[model samples]
Target chain A: MTHKKNTKAIKLVTMIMLTSVAQAQVTINQKLTASIYSDNKNGVEGDDGYKLIEERLEIRGNGQNIEAYARIDLTKFIDAPSSDYRDDERLERLLTSYHLGDWRIDIGDIHLEMGRGIALSLKPIESAGVDTALRGGQMAYQSKKIEFNIFGGEANPANLDTLSQKHVVDTPDRIIGIRGQIQANKALPTIGIFGIYLKPDDQKLNELLNAEKEDQNITTGITIQAREILNTFDIYIEGDYQKRRLIDQEETGKAIYSTIDLTIKETIILIEGIYLNGFEQRGSPHTATDTRVSYNRPPTLERIDQEVLETRDILGGRIRLERPIISEDYVGHINGMYRIQSPDSEEEITQIHGYAGLEIYLPDKLAFSGGYRDERYSGGALKGEKLKSMIHGEGDLTVGLEGYELHAQSTNELRRRPSDGDSGGEKRYARGSTLLGLERGGRMGLTLEYGYDTEKEGVRQHFFAGIAHWKFLEGQKLRLAAGTQRGGVKCIAGICREYPAFAGARFEWLGHF
Target chain B: MKYTLLAALLLSLSAPQSRADERPLAPEIKGKSTQDELINVADYKGKTTIILFWATWCAPCKKAIPEFIKIQEEIGEDKIQIIAINMDDAQTRSRVKSTIKRNKWKMPIILDTDGTIAKKINSTNSAPYTVVIDKQGKIAYSEEGYTSDNAEKWAERLKKLSTEP
Candidate 1:
């Protein structure tokens, strides 16, 4: 199909879907955000004096046993189109589903994730820019003991932003998958098996700079998973085998992941492990790792940057324990992990990390917490070899008064590394922050943070003012904040993203109709 | 950035539509619990019930569960019941089971891996969603998100709901 024709068809379908959804009793949730940045120095790379706006609209409705949802996002730069503007403004997601007696059918962008996302996952990772929406249809059947799912369609292009910027690609890659599970007997474990096949189309026009064409392969994989929850323990295991073939090269990958959680009284112990051989992890490269033929990642693997997934051969395990130290009010935790990785045609890297922490809760008035961490990494290539052995030790303390209304925290870190060429020394860092407001006394407050690095003799300071109103105007939640801070990694849940230094303002308002 | 003004205008046009009369009856949901037993929501029709849709990976859900537990304790089981419907997919089922057990929540929980029940209630695609059903089997309140002090508000609402004829 021609590009213009395809675009017109998509627009027509979108409008029809929107009109149908708007007629129903629907609720529209809208978010509008604008950020202004100004940085004189080059300290904050890729960010200059500019303004960016992001607009999001989500509509949801249910009628006649069918549910519908749509999200439209538009992002634009002020004045002129920034280099990145080409990647802005796209129909993010559209979905409609209906259920029959024992069967369900879903069409349009499907963002489904299966068993820990090992074999096939249509889950989008925003930070990593890993896209996984299938613009297709799914059929599912459920019974007392057996369930089946079959889906086929084009997977959202891996490089959505790049494709948006260029807009020359004709067809997205095709994806087909089938999954089934059987209870068989209630006394036995529930077992599931899934298989997926993917074939990239027209790679010549849709070239990606960061990805190697050799990496583009017709990939297929199958996964088997089992789960059993004993009286005191919960155990899960999954094994995956994938095969990829290019015109010249063919490779097979295998991975095994498992987790066991044992609960005894008030204490919890968890053991998780992963082993990979020639498995190039799949997700979004923007997501802190590599991308592969299949959209699968050992979602339970723990590492700083998914570094373990970067290697061709990898093995890792982690253990964590939580228990009461002395009484019901005091709790302690200990965790440790070790990993070894060998990147394809590269040197092997080994890492070991551990941490211990304790928290004491005082009856509704005050609380205190302290923690210690030790991290070490070694091995790699020449320049990376000099990057060789590096060790980091850190400690933190936090005290809260009146249930965190008045809170203060301090963190200190010491790092030791082998001298590169001439510089042979250790680095020390100390950081502190204070939060001054709770919901009761003040609707607005101030936050102050400072960080000092001894080796670089750099001092970073940030001051933020925030205000939150729960019942603003008409039962709306409005939160506003303005701040200036240094660039660093921001983490939510276990996902982390590195952001540039910024001085900006943020406003949020949430209301439902 | 000119779209900012357009977005703001769109936001201003939204009118607060009354929703109490439009809510459909709760779907009949029956699922296996982490304890390996069947739990049916319809069985609790005679008592005020709060069904909180949650997941183990959601930070807010983790925060809200403990508070819901406290609220359940204050309201007492006879006056009201709180059921947590887990929305984690099958891959994370084990994690969900372990997390609930470790927290020692006293409320009954149902595993809804397919999310059929949650979809019937509301399709916001998130955790920490809450629905309060009155003793007469009508939805009194349904909220899509959570705040720090929502538990106190829920307790107040439950107390008021318990007194309703």
Candidate 2:
């Protein structure tokens, strides 16, 4: 019955959007991506080789007081054995925004962000290939001094699992959100209060052995932002209190994320802190695996490449200082952090990390940036503990050659792989990707890529790939890439995702009308 | 799926093949600059504007922004303008102010904390993504990723747009 209702609603929205497009100016865009790769050749990869294709189309229409949007996705697998992946087609997203005086109404998909996301953040994370939205409507009122927003709907997640090349678990949770903000004016700071409530589908939660239904799953927070308050300092503070039940047990969570910045001329000094104690929320319903889905992604207060596990019961902060080099396009920074975290059962672990780096840019578009980091982990109830460190750099060099340009872009990570057990020694490896290409008019290019490595799969392996691209028509690109790239653990916004290795050829075309 | 794609392609072909300057105005947007000031893109209607989306962790962005600043200076504010939009999420939100200050940027840096502007403009969501708006507030052109090759063409295009009525 719900499926039928959704279909009917989708048809209605589509009709409305089509009507709007015919009446108002429209922007049409689409992306077509197809790949053929070797999989399941060995352990943990896949069962076999296959070919797959996906297409996404988006259309937007704007009128005097109304805006309409529609997006659809289609994916297919060809000549493949029975496997985890599946072929499907569906309307991915639809949104209609209507404006009336100082009030606005949004129906279909809604994106919400409260403060620094300690209470709620429903959007997209490109690195994780995650884009979750509230499939409902929102009402917002805005004026010179105040803003209010409220919305409720089912939390819908992107169905495609890029890493697994399969459909994600299709379970959604009901959610409601409310927010009110006071615009900062004069010497006063801007303040806001926000809340998000979630209730998982009982049947889906029952599929998990130890899960339980809850009366209410809510997270509420307040934020205070003071910019240039002291002629040199800017401060942002947010606190959240969560009341949720996922496991058979009942528990609550709390989190606080704050940052203070001292800005002077071309230098900035920052002090940041993060305190999260059981601050977890249900994401994409009850999935047996991948449980670190806290809708409120607290800041990690660490580097994006920091190799560390995230903990709900985490307490830590970092201090960073950055400055420019005298009117030139050069920058430098230093940072340090310390944290104590636990896995809800084990003893708390202590971690300390520090890093520094410099970036250089030339007038001719040649640039280089490099950094070094050292992180130590100990004091936990573990068998092996040690310090982790790495050096990373990335840049591009462009040179003009007789009627053409020769360009090279690369990113590198050289790190010390810590020992797995108490007795094993450490191993060192360099994993960085480089692309070298030559272009005639910046419209067409052929490139070769190599040197990126991975070893977590028990062996040190290297990767190589090649690409050919052409920019045709007004705004269109056709790109083809073939390579074997090993995947590993990558973190974004304090959450981590593991990607499986890939050996394949892929084709993509992006266009806008 | 094939039929759907075919239909989409046909629809694209039927779209009015007009110049980007003839396109409708860039979606009206409002955001807060890193320096704690509210700004609306609509305010830039009479001037040629360049909207560039970037992130702190994007390597190419580090290379592209300096040149963009240089372009803004050379073209002069009376003719062309550049408004940067930072696309960092909460995990990296704290870096925006420091990053901007460290670069000594005088241009307003719009912070897209919630991605509303990106969604409204149909952003590619890639770092170094850039769009050009003509004096009439119409979207003239856009490009994804940054390279030395694109910079030369983009600068030329900006100059061309600045010369228009």
Query: Which structure among the candidates has the greatest TM-score?
Result: 2
Clashes of each: 3, 1
lDDT (CA) for every model shown? 0.56, 0.73
Q: What is the C-alpha local distance difference test score of candidate 2?
A: 0.73
The candidate scoring highest on lDDT is 2
Per-model TM against the reference: 0.77, 0.89
Which ten-residue region of model 1 chain A has the weakest summed lDDT?
Answer: A161-170
* Candidate 2 residue-wise lDDT, A1-513, digit = tens: 563465458547754755555454677778899988676223663434888898888777776667777778788998654555778887777787777766888888777788877777886875676677778889998665678899988766667776666676555567888998886575788888988888765444545564555445788999888888768899999888988766555679988889999977767899999888888765654242355345666677877655556657788889988776654566677788887776344565666666666665554446665666655544455524545667788777766565566778887888885767765799777777788988766578888877556545544377777888898876788999888765666666665777666678989998887
Q: Candidate 1's residue-wise lDDT over A1-513, tens digit each?
A: 433443345445544654554444455665666666655232534456666666566655544446565666676666433454433665566667676666778776675555565555555444433455677778987666777789877655433332112122224566677887776777666677777776665444334443344334333333333344556666767777778654435788777778788878788887888777876533222311322334554453442322222434678787878787788556676777777665343555666666666655452323333333333334434324333232333333323234234434444444444544556654444333344444432223234544433322332344343434444433244565566544454333234444454566656565545
Q: Mark the 10 consecutive residues where model 1 chain B has the least summed lDDT.
A: B9-18
- What is the fnat score of candidate 1? 0.04
Q: Candidates' DockQ values?
A: 0.23, 0.43
User: What does the lDDT read for residue A232 in candidate 1?
Assistant: 67
